[model samples]
Target chain A: MNLTIKATKNNTFDAVVVGSGMTGGFAAKELTERGLKVLMIERGREIKHIEGYDTAMKQPWEIEHRGKTTNVSAEERWANSRFWGLGSEEVVNHLTNDKENPYIEKRPFDWIRAYHTGGKSMHWGRQSYRWNKQDFEANAKEGIGIDWPIRYEDLEPWYAHVEKFVGVSGQKEGWDVLPDGHFLPPMPMFAPEVHFKKMMTEKLSRPVTIGRIANLTQPQKVHTDLGRASCQYRSKCARGCPYGGYYSSLSGAIPAAMQTKRLSILHDSIVSEIIYDEQKKRAIGVRVIDQHTHAVTEFFAKIIFLNAGSINTAALMLNSKSNRFQNGFGNDSDQVGRNLMDHQLGSGAMASIDGFEDDYVYGQRPNALYIPRFRNWGNDKQTAYLRGFGYQGGASREGWESGVNADGFGADFKKSLTKPGPWSIRIGGFGEILPNPNNRIYLDSEKKDKWGIPMIVTDAAFVENDWAMRKDIIASAVEMLDTAGFKNVTSYDRPTHMGLGIHDMGTARMGRDPKTSVLNAYNQVHDCKNVFVTDGAAMASSSCVNPSITYMALTARAVDYAVKALKKRES
Target chain B: MLGGAFSAPTLMAMNHWEQATSPTIEGAAFSLSDTHRKIVAEIAEMIIPRTDTPGAKDAGVPAFIEMMLKDCYAQSEHLSFTEGLASMEQVKFLELNEAERRGVLKYLEQQTKEKMKAMPKGTPFWRLMKELTLLGYFTSEAGIKASFDYVQIPGKLENIKLKPNQKAYAY
Candidate 1:
C-alpha cells in the first residue's frame, strides 16, 4: 500500500498521543480537556466500554476448558503466553504475538501484555500506590543512578488529581514511605487478614494494610459520572470489568477524553516511528503501519506523546534516526535504551489455616492485603540490600481442588465440598530492582516484527540486591504466618528472571541533564522539546509498588506542561 | 440431585457397554477400549464409592476423565497413565484379589509422591488421575451439593461457626 501524508503542513493537531493505554488515555483526556485537539493512535483493535467485555459476567461453570490452557492454540501462536483465562481469546488476538514479534531473552522473561485501545490497563492488577519522597530521592541519596529532575512534590498534586478521577479505594494510615492518596472507601479486610495485621503490628512493629486498589468500594461522583459502579467483588477484572468497577483506560480516561469532543482515536494503527523535522527541530508527526492491511500512512501533529510502553517506545525512538540525529532521536546521552528495570517477584509462600471452614466469604475479592515496605526505613536501614520490597497477599478457604486426596465418593464428597475447605493464605513479594545501566533493552535492527518495526532485544537480569531482598521476602512471610498461630506454614522461592514481573520500566529514564538521560523532568526529550515519553520508559527508578498508577499521574502532568508550552511557542 | 436421576443399573450399563466399545462417535475418535473404560469407571467409583449418594459412575466422572485425558493430556502423559493402568493389570495377572489390587494402588500412590518430590516438573499419571477424579467429582451435582454444600448466588457474607457434622464444599 502507498503512503499518503494527509497533513502536508497545515493539518497538525494540538497534540498526538501514540498509545491509548494507562498513560496515553490520561494524556488524551488531560490534553483534550485543556482545550487541545488530541489525536490518539492505538496499535491494537478498538475495545469499547461494557460492550467489549463479553465474558465479564460469566460464572465459573460457564466457560470451556475450565481456565486450562490448550496446546493447539499455544503452539500455533506465541501470544498464548499472555492469554490467561477462559474468555481471553479475543483480546489475545490483539496482543503482540511471540512468533511475529520475537525478542531474544538472555534469561527467561514472561513479557505478559495485551495491546488494545486501553492496552494492558484493562488487565492491570489495579493496586495503586503513591511514590514517597524517599522513592523520588533514592537515586540522588544512594548515588546509584542519575538524580530525578523532578521530586515527589512536583507530581504529588497530579497524583491526587488522577487518584480522585480513578477513584482509588484505600485506607489513609498516614505512612511517610507509601503516603496517603485521594481515596474512596477502602474495601473491608477479611477476618484472617485483620487478625494477621494485628499480630504483625504487635510483634514486628510494622503495619499491614488492605491493598490501595483502584477498585471503587464506594462509588464517588467521578465514578458515577463516568458510568462506573462499585466493584461486585468478582475478582475477574483481568477479563475486563463490565461494571467499570476497576480503573482501566476504558473505564476511566477514554470516556472522559471522549466527553471533551476534541479527541479522535484510530485503533490498529501501529506507529512505526516519530517523523523528526530537521529545520523545525521538532517532531512533525508519526508514520503508522495499518496492522490489518500492512498499509503505511502518516499523520501530522505539532506535539507527540509516545506512551507505547517502555521497550516499544524506546525502540521507536531508536528507529527514528534522521540526517540531523544520526544515532537516534534524543540519543545524545545514549541512554534511550539503558537503565531497564522490573520488580522481582514470585518469591514467597502460602500456608494452610486449619480453621475458617464454616465461615465463608461472599465474593472473590479483587484486591489483596498489602504489607508495605519495611526495609531501609527509620532506624532499620541495616539490610543485606539497599532498596526494599512490599508484599501483597490474602487468606481464603480452600476450594474443591484442595481436597483431591481425601477419601470419599458420591454423597460424602458432595457433602464435604458444599461448605468451605480449610483456610489458606499466600504472601508474594514485589521487590524493587535498582536501575542498573547493565540491565538494558536495545533495538535489534537486524530483526523486524510482523508490524515491520525493529524487535526489542532485552539483556536484563536480576542482581545481588534482588537476590538478597528475596531471601528476606520469603523469610518474613514465613515468620508472619508462623507468628499468626497458623500451622503447616511453608515458604517457597520460585526462580524468576527479569521482565517476568511485567512491570518493565526505566529504559528512557528522566534526569536533570540531557547528557545523562533521554527524557527531562516533564517527560520531554531534552534535545527535542516537541516529543514526550510519559510511559514507564521515563521512570527514574522502579518503585516496589505497581508502576501504572505513577505513569498515569506523570502522563497527566506532562500533558498539562506540553499544552502550556505549545501555547507559549516554546517548541 | 442430577446424578440420582440416572439409576445405578443404568449408570452401570452406561459404564460397561454404552458408548464404550465405539471407536468413532459422529466421526470423532473415542480411543479407550470397553474393558479399559470399565476399569477406569470402576476405579473412579471405588475411589469415591456410592455411600448415601450417587457414585462416581452416577456423577459421570468416568466419562469426564476419559474425555479430559484424550483432549487435555500430552502424549507422554497419556502414555504414562496407560502404563500405570497396565501395571495394575500386571498385579491382577499374578492372580491377585480385588483387595490386593487396591493395596497395590495404595503403594503406587506413595511411590508417585516420592517421584514428585524428586522431580517437580510436568504432571505425572497418578497426579492426572487424582486431578481428574477431583474435577469430575466436585463439578457433579451430587458431588457438589451432597459432599460439599453449594450456594448459587450467595448474596451476603456470613461468618458462621462450623457444626460438628458440617460438610465441606465440592468446589
Candidate 2:
C-alpha cells in the first residue's frame, strides 16, 4: 500500500482553539463573537448537537444490562470500572476506553477522559458553583503554592456572562463562602432533602441547598433560539440529553460559534505540538496528525488556545520541544506539568431513614442536594485541614435493585417489591487537594499511545493534608446524618486515588511571577504571549467545587483580554 | 414536558449491546447443558412462582441468568455456582414432582444459612441463584412491562402519594 505524501498551505485563521470541550467551546464562541475567524480542532469524531444524541430516551425494559457492569467492561475500564453508575450500559460510550487511550500510572491515578466533539461536557454532572473571594486568597494566605493572579471579583462578571448563556439552575443563597450566580428557577428538592436541610440548619448550623446544576429548569429565549429545551427530568444525563436539556458544548456554545459562520471545526485532528517560531519568539501555528490517515498537517493562526484538558494540555506543551524550548515549549520554568491535583474524595456517610414511605418521588431527578464547604472558613477555621470540603448527595427510596441482596422470592417477594423499601440518604465529600510540585505528570518519552503521541506518566498522589481533610469529611457527614434523625447511620472512608474525581487541575498554574508559573493572569503563556490555555491547567488551587463553571468563566475572561491585546497590537 | 418518544439510556444500552455482542445475539452463550438449563429454569420458576404474574421461566429469565453468570460473574463466583450445582441431587431434578422439588429447595435454603456462617465471602449458591433470578426477572420486558408499571417518560418530575394497592413505577 503506497501512502502518498500530502502537504497543503498552512491553514490560516485569526485564532485556533484546540480541544472542543468546556473551555474550548467557550473560547470558540467568545473569539468568533469578537469577529475573529476561529478554527476549533478536536481529536475525536464529530457528534452533531441534538441529532447525535442516541440514547437520550430509553425505557427501563429497553435496557439490556439494566445498569449491570459486565466482566469485559470491568477488565477494559480497569481504573474507572468502580465508578458505580458510570459503568451503566448507556454512559459507557461517553467515556474514553482505557485500552485505546492508555496512560502510565506510577500510582493508581484514575485518568478518566472523554474524547469526542462535545468531550466530557456531554456527560458532566453540571454541578455549577462560584468560588468565593476566600478561595482565590487561600494559597497566598496559607503560603502553599503560588498565589492566584486574579481574584473572585475579576471573575464574577465573567461568571455571570457564562451563566446567562448556559442557563444555570440554582438558588441564590447570599453566602460569602459560595458566591451567587445568574440563575434560572432552581430545581425543586425532594421532600426528604427538605427535611434533612432543616435538620442540618437547626443542629449543625450548616446550609444544605439544592445543587446549582447547569441544566435549564426554565429555558430563556437565548437557549430556545439555539434549539435547546428545558430539563425533562429523565436523569439519564450521562447518556447525553437529546432535548439539549443541559449545558454542553454541543447544545450550547459550539452551535452559537457555528451560527456566526466565522468558526470552523476540524475533527479527528490530534494536535501533535505547538509550532513556535524561534525568531518571532511566539507560537505561529500547530502541527496535527490526521487520526485516520496518519498524515501530518500544519495550521497557522495569529493566536492559539490550548483547552485540551489539564493533563493533555500539559503533555502537549511538554512534548512540543523546540530549539528555544529544548526541554519543552513553555517549559522555561520547568513547570509545564507540575502541580497536578484532583479533589480528594471517597469518604462520607450513608443512613436509612425511618419514614417518607408516602412522600416518595417518581422520576429520576438529575441533580443532588449540595452542602457547601463550612470548615476552614470564617468563624469555623479548622486546624485539622488547610482548605475545606463540600458534599453532594441525594435521598431516595430503595428500588428493585436493592432486592439483589434481600431475602425472599415467590408471590410474597414480588408483592413486597411492588412498593418501595426503606428511604436511604447517602452523601460523599469532595475535599480540596493542595498543589504539590512533586505531585506531577511527565511525558513518558519512550512509551507511545495508539496515536503515536507520548503516553503521559502520572506520578501524582494525595498528601497528608488531603487525608486529614477526609477524616473531618467523614466525621461531619456522619454527624449531619445522625442529627437529621436518620437511623443506622454508617460512615466510610474508602481508598480514593488521584484523578478519580475527574476534576484534574493546576498542571500549568496561573501566578503573578513568570518564573514561578507558565500562564499569566490572562491565561497567556509567559514565554509565548500569543498562546493561551484556559482549561483546568490554569488553576492555581483545587477549590472544593466542580470546576467546569470556573473553566467557562476563565475562558470567557481570557478571550476578552486576548482579543483586546490582539487589537492593541494591530493599532 | 417529557413528550419525547426516545429514551437515551435504552438507546445507548441497545447500541452497547450491539457493539459488545456483535453478530451473536444476547444469551446465545448459555454455557450450560440442556438438562442443566432445564433444572436452572425450574429453580428460577420456583423462586418466582406463577401467581397473578408470570413466573421467571415465562419471562425468559433462565437464559439471562446463564448469560449473566457466564459473562458477568467472577471466577470464584463461577466456581461456587458450578460446585454448588454439582452437590445438588443430580437425579433429573426438573423431572421430580412439584412437591419433591419444593422439598429439595427448602432443604437447600436451610443448607445455605448453615454454609453462610463458615464461608468467608459466602458465595452461597442459593443467594447467587436468587439474586440472579430477581435481577433477570425484574429487568425483563415480561416482568417490568407485563406485570409492573413502566412509564417511558414522566414529562416532569413530581412527588406523589400512592393509594393502597398501587404498584410502584419501574424505573
Name the candidate that leads on TM-score: 2
Indicate the DockQ of the complex predicted as candidate 1: 0.29
Interface root-mean-square deviation for each candidate? 3.7, 1.9
Candidate 1, CAPRI quality class derived from DockQ: acceptable
Model 2 misplaced regions, further than 4 Å: A1-10, B1-30, B90-122
Which one wins on lDDT?
Answer: 2
Candidate 1 local accuracy as lDDT?
Answer: 0.77
Which ten contiguous residues of candidate 2 chain A have the minimum total lDDT? A1-10
Q: For candidate 2, write residues B26-49 as lDDT tens digits.
A: 323326667667778888988888
Q: Model 2 captures what fraction of native contacts?
A: 0.59
The C-alpha TM-scores of every prediction are: 0.89, 0.92
DockQ of 2: 0.39
Tell me what fraction of the real C-alpha contacts between chains A and B each candidate also makes. Answer: 0.39, 0.59
What is the C-alpha lDDT profile of model 1 across A1-571, one tens digit per residue? 0122243434467788999888999998899899988888888778778887866665444444445545554554443353243223434443555665567765555566567878888887899999999999988989988898988899999999999999898999998988998888877777777888999999888889989999888888878998998887656677788788899889999899888888888887888988998888888999888888988878888889999999888888889989877888888898888898999888888888766555656656778899989988877884589979899998887777765765433445545655567788999999999988888878776777777777777888888998889999999889889998888888988776777677989989999888899888899999899899999999999879899889988998998888888888854
